[model samples]
Target chain A: MGRRNDHSRQEIREMALQVAEKIVAKEGLQGLNARKIASAIGYSVGSLYIVFENLDDLILQVNARSLDQLYTVISKTEQQCRQPDACLLALGQAYLEFAMEQPQRWRTVFEYQRTKDAEIPSWYRKKIFRLFKLVEKPLLEFMPTLEPHLCAQTARALWGGVHGICILALTGRLEIVGADSVQNLMELLITNYLAGLKNVQGTPCTPEEGTTQECKA
Target chain B: MGRRNDHSRQEIREMALQVAEKIVAKEGLQGLNARKIASAIGYSVGSLYIVFENLDDLILQVNARSLDQLYTVISKTEQQCRQPDACLLALGQAYLEFAMEQPQRWRTVFEYQRTKDAEIPSWYRKKIFRLFKLVEKPLLEFMPTLEPHLCAQTARALWGGVHGICILALTGRLEIVGADSVQNLMELLITNYLAGLKNVQGTPCTPEEGTTQECKA
Candidate 1:
């Protein structure tokens, strides 16, 4: 191992995360561990621990970086399409592309589980929330009078559906139903979901059955 | 271990699967292993190998059974709700309920990955398809003019969205957006997706952008 004073703390931290991401990219999350990362970065495992609390903490940081990259990718969709619905479709397509391009890294962000009672750190939570904000802006533009909480809820529901399509398609579960392509399924989801949202504002005759059912209960 | 002659091959296969399911249910897929299953069932590891090809095979069988149970749960929704849209909502609720009630087993159906290039057995594929068939029935009834392939594709796209919500909610990822309940999010997904489908049939002017785009491409 190099001398402890040889590299600044920030340098070492960046180095460790880079090495960790490489391991996950080449080999799935099951292949990642401290010893391999330390060896790859030319540092002792002790030094690795000095920079992060534990493996879980290291994974959380890696996931945070992934979320940042995803946010950047999805945000770019905003400049490509003029219509709110079109922008959401472009965002869903970008998401599916990212997952296909970086399967392991993308899966790592969702697959890493904390201990049952452990809380997700606030910093990590904030990174994920930022991703949702990209969707929220376009949604609010579509429905100007929608309450803030309902806006957030609508964004989550819509994004959650897109996220689900990507997960099933990437995981091969989509094969059971004879799905042709991730792109097609994603387009279907975004188009249908946006259509439904438009219907809410266009028609007063068709009540929001989901909300009505909730109110009754 | 009991005498090798104490049980027939079918008996051993059934016993091993039961034990494996319990382990997965209590500890998630990471905690499952052949040694653990054998010990739990009071059999030798060799006996496990005799009944199944390996741990992957055992997991496939267990997952197949989980899918069967899921199909049963979703299929029951058919009898409870006569209307196509209402039935789809009931199915979504049952799906969310199943995921919440049996998080491990439901997750294992998706989380267990076979070795790259290993084909999922036909039996397992058929069980999963039956689950899709439940969704397909209601979808076709709602859109009788929809082509057969489109019906299958629509079923997959809609159900994939529901599955995604369950995965995110069950894993605590939805907490970032402060999701109220799995039931509410699921209801939103089904209602919107169905609404979108209804619009496709009700309005000749809105052009199915998703399908039209595909044809143009």
Candidate 2:
């Protein structure tokens, strides 16, 4: 009886998440209410509380699940390519493809407000590092001499550019630029970013070095 | 009495937009509704309808005004920079800055949905073009050899990348990739995109381009 009850509890939480996703996808986060979700699942409001502490907790669970899914998509893409730059490009493409495919889920992951401030939680931060490590670790092999900080910064720039393209395409604002083929543009962007990495790696340490030396002197 | 009534009509419309902005900023777009807006302005719901056909129409009007304000920001940024590429970079930076500074208004632009999808009216299209022409016209000066269609596609690609970054960064997803300074990343992206324009302008068609002729032969 205990095992069966635990399984049922898990089932109810999954169902609640599905219904919440449906509500957010259709009516957006604003339309999401516990009563509405319970009604959607044909359960009483009290049943929802059994699974989730409150509405905010439910949203955080959904948001975390969505991020995990997004991370999985990027990881799968990275594994398909062996070359450092190719792997990085694949990760960027996958990130773009995921955002375009799941616009509502993508929005939910970003738009949901959590209690955590500027610093993300440790587990979430690990997932983030895992995603970057896929690109950054391979990149170290190709550009063996790059400083860790610069490598991370370049990875971030490329990632930001890809993330930005996905949002623009999904939101329909890309029309302002008169483009249709997101895939081609993304490829070109990744190519350019990779090329720029060579330059950034070779960037003179004069400015950074000067500041530090002046401070010390 | 007729002239006074007309003046009051304009005053009410402006007042409604102000209240709507306040509601959205403080509580998110979900907080905006007729009753709350009317209560905030000390007006009856009927008075709101005098200037707005419905709540959707009111939101649309407010959106139009917001987009106009957004365009004005772009224009000011462009005017401050003389070089075509610099102008594009400045405009993009200003855009990201605006979204970060006023995240609520930025989200309202992306997240708020129109109630109906009729033909896009002329005024709306014009508003869209105003932002585009800032980049399209000046970009043409720099890439004079490229055809119009190609130019539009390239411009859209650049615009899409920048806009996507702003949305993702504002929503906390960019933290996943460890993006530190959005402004510096945007500068690097714009510089790289401008550099790549040379190949698009000067390079002769490669074998892939002449495939139709080769296949016929």
The numbered model that scores best in lDDT is 1
Where in model 2 is the C-alpha error above 4 Å?
Answer: A1-61, A78-90, A116-119, A135-146, A175-177, A195-217, B1-11, B38-44, B173-177, B199-217
lDDT of 1 by residue, B1-217 (tens): 4566698999999988988888889999999989888888788899889989988888999998898888887788877887788888898889988999999999888877787888987877788778888889988887786677788888888888998898998877787567777777777677777777767545555444343323433
Specify the CAPRI tier of model 1.
medium
Per-residue lDDT tens digits of candidate 2, residues B11-78?
87888899897777677778889998877777779888988888887776666777798888878875
What stretches of model 1 exceed 4 Å from their correct place? A116-118, A205-217, B205-217
The whole-model lDDT of each prediction reads: 0.81, 0.69
Distance (Å) between predicted and true CA of A155, model 1?
Answer: 1.2
The residue-by-residue lDDT of candidate 2 on A89-129, one tens digit each, is: 67777887788777777777777776664345577677767
Which 10 successive residues of model 1 chain B have the least lDDT summed?
B208-217
The alpha-carbon deviation from the true structure for residue B203 of candidate 1, after best TM-score superposition, in angstroms, is 3.3
Error of model 1, residue B104, in angstroms: 1.8
- Which window of 10 residues has the lowest lDDT sum in candidate 2 chain B? B208-217
